[model samples]
Target: MEVEITTEEKILIAARKVFIEKGWDGARMQEIADNAGINKALLHYYFRNKEQLFKRVFAGIVGKLIPNLNTIIQSEQPIFEKIQAFIDAYLDFLLANQELPLFVANELSRNANLIVGAFEENGLKPMVGQMVMEIFQAIENKQIRPINPAHLLMNIVSMCVFPFMGRSIFQKVLMQVPEEMYQELLKQRKKEIYEMVYHSIVL
Candidate 1:
């Protein structure tokens, strides 16, 4: 069955693209309307102004992507298995939402508090203690070498995020790689990242 998409949804989709590409300061209402195939009056009717529209777009994207990090720390699977699962899920999500990494990186640089607030509002916080305990347990079991969970978390995030975040520059300017090849490289990242992380910590 064909799903019906409402006007509001259309607006939001259009806004997401514009906000990601042009960013909050660069996006304009008329451009969003053109993207959505709607008039400015209707856009304004749906979203009173640019700020309101941007907030909804930002929140929607962050809510979808950021909260899933909890699953890796909370899972009952062994540490290596959890890492593999996280890489699979995180990379898949990032690949499907290519624009998201840059958008998130930019937002985090400009107004980090907003991103933090979004996570808190979405009930994705208060897991730090749990994550630390999980890491300690893994080390005690000799599943991984003893290390600060924060460093491990950052390593995971950087490996998963930097490629997408620097796609244009790294893949295009410096590497001068063809889009097809870069895409193929991305396809192999799940295993590549898993092996790298596993070897870093495992005995």
Candidate 2:
């Protein structure tokens, strides 16, 4: 049985594709309405304007990606174990949403406040504080080397996110690997990233 997609769902589906492809500045209401098989008037009826539509789409993406970090960071797992789990989950999400990094980069370049607002609204600051405290505890117990927690966190995020953001140059130009092979490389990165991060901080 084919499930019926609601009017709002259809609008969101079309809006996500349009916004991701064009960013906030380039996306058009007519294009979104056409993609959704609706009229522009109806689109405006659902969302007041393009900014509102873009915010809705951006919020949904950030909501999915950020809440998981909060959950994992708050868990009682050891620091290294948390690191491994975070890499696994983060890579899995990026694999599914390969276009996300580029889209986010483009949008952020246009308006930094969008991403910052999303993070603030999601309680990411407290999560970061918790993770830093965990790193401090690990260092105190001699579980890891003495490293700045902020730097370690930045390194971990860069390693996980940069490949996706630079996929075209890294996969096509530099590596010159085919799509299937490139996918395999990303899968391998989960373990590879965990090991690299583990060794970097471990004594």
Candidate 3:
């Protein structure tokens, strides 16, 4: 048996669905109200306006971003292991919420400042931009080879995130491995991918 949720919770759930489907531009307060089985006035009584409601939903999505990645980004772990862990964690985050990346990208495109503010709020600070510089310095200090760390990071993320992010495109135009099969593939990828990354970075 399932207990019913409060109207506020219902509104938030409806907003999430609308935002994911229509993005920030296309989402409408009336649509959200309709989705929640409430009138627009009731939705307004709860959320004030569409923008406020949108923020609530967007904030929840932003919070899904794992903060621990910052520690891993600056870690002394062998760069390859760090890369593998990063891919696994990041991809796992997306797997848990398939619409998140697209939602962020879409909303950011709508308001770059909002995206920046969200990052700041999330304590990501400026770590991503400097992540490569720190890695390069490690290489210069003989901790690793002179390979480009930013390129490595991007490649690993692309391999992990893109396959699923572009799942429809891949299944339609290229491969059509079932979802479970893809999950199995991802499960087996960490080791091989790390070895490949290790080979590139190790002296």
Candidate 4:
């Protein structure tokens, strides 16, 4: 079945591709419009300017990642189950949007306040506190080691997110693996992270 694509939708998708390949500095409004098969005037009519367009695209990215995240953290699932599911789902999100992470990192370097604003609008702050308390209870029950779960959680996230952010370097400077081989390496990481974390946390 063929799905319909709107002019705005086309522009956003095209912008996402360009921004990922070029980063914001290298991306051009005219190039985005060309990619979308629309004129720059039409793009402006919808998005106003480059910064506005990036914010809209970034909001879409955050929305995709955050909603289900809050639900999983607040759920009554055991920590191990949550760990497996969270890693799987998060990796899926990363793979689906390969350009998303770098664009976000680039944009964050420019204006953290913008991303913070999106988090506020999206109600992400409350979820952090919720996850911390959930972790506290798991520790009290001896389900996991007595680590500061918040810091531990942050480390887990960094372990996952950093490799993607550093993908170019990992492939070129480190392993020097070409495209197909490097993808297989990433496939291994999905389970490896879970195993590494599980063994570290359990006695």
lDDT (CA) per prediction: 0.83, 0.86, 0.74, 0.81
Q: Give stretches of model 4 more than 4 Å off.
A: 121-126
Task: Report the candidate with higher TM-score, 1 versus 3.
Answer: 1
Model 2, residue 117: distance off in Å is: 2.9
Worst-scoring 10-residue span by lDDT in model 3: 118-127
By TM-score, how accurate is candidate 1? 0.87
Tens digit of lDDT per residue, candidate 1, span 164-200?
A: 9999998989999999999888888999999999899
Put the candidates in TM-score order, highest first.
Answer: 2, 4, 1, 3
TM, every model:
0.87, 0.94, 0.77, 0.87
The prediction achieving the highest TM-score against the true structure is: 2
Model 1's alpha-carbon lDDT is 0.83
Q: What's model 3's TM-score?
A: 0.77
User: Largest lDDT belongs to which candidate?
Assistant: 2
lDDT of 2: 0.86
Error of 3 at 119 (Å): 3.6
Task: State each model's C-alpha RMSD to the native.
Answer: 2.3, 1.5, 3.2, 2.2
